[model samples]
Structures are given as structure tokens and as C-alpha cells.
Target: DPAEAVPAIAPTTVEEVNTRFVVLAELYEHDIQDFHALLEGHEAGDERYAERVDISARAVKERETA
Candidate 1:
């Protein structure tokens, strides 16, 4: 089920968002980098992993822009 798991950006109000994102980072830390970059621009419906990348990227962008 590891492959089925994907990182996501939780709502700002959700505490678990940080925890879950950390878990995802630990899990996928060595899995992919090029893949993540390639998928960052993808529409969520393109794939689950793609959605995860989008979510993660948006989270970073949101913070950076803030």
C-alpha cells in the first residue's frame, strides 16, 4: 500500500497536515525527485501522485508567498 500512499496538503486548520506531510516526506524521501518535479505542474486528476505533488507544491508556494 506504500505506492498507493501519496503526500497531500491538509487544510490549514488541520493539525495532522504537518504530521502527515512529514510522514510522506520520510516515506518518499528517496523514492523520487525527478518524478516529483515532472508532476508538480500536473492537474490533480492526472494521477494520485501528481495530485500529491500539486498539493505539496501549493503548500510551499502558499507559505513562500505569505
Candidate 2:
């Protein structure tokens, strides 16, 4: 699943900044899990490495947008 959308405006207030931080934290947490899964799949010599890599790439793109 994709992370929640962040405020489009620059975070000018403390609350806005905090909200952004929370959103980013959640995004990174999921990113870490995706990477872990990719690594495990690589180590096991899984036939689906390419698919896992695509997943990881998409997750990275999601992070970039956030």
C-alpha cells in the first residue's frame, strides 16, 4: 500500500511539520521492510528476484514522491 499523502503546501506551522514527519517515518519504515524482503530473496537465490526488485524500485519511487 502507498503511504498517506502529505500536505502540498510547505510546512509552515509546527503541527504541519509534525504531520509531515509522521508520514515520512511511516514511508521509510515500509521502505525498510521492502528492502529486507528483497535482500532475503536475493540470499535464497529465489527465481523471483526480478519481481522483488521491481517491488523495491516502486517503493523507492513512492518514497521520492513523499
Among these predictions, the greatest lDDT belongs to 2
TM-score of 2: 0.52
Clashes of each: 0, 0
lDDT of each: 0.78, 0.87
lDDT of 1: 0.78
In candidate 1, stretches whose alpha carbon ends up further than 4 angstroms from where it belongs are 1-46
The candidate 2 region of ten consecutive residues with least summed lDDT is: 1-10
| Tens digits of per-residue lDDT for model 2, 18-61 | 99899999999999999999998787876577679999999999
How far off is model 1, as Cα RMSD? 24.0
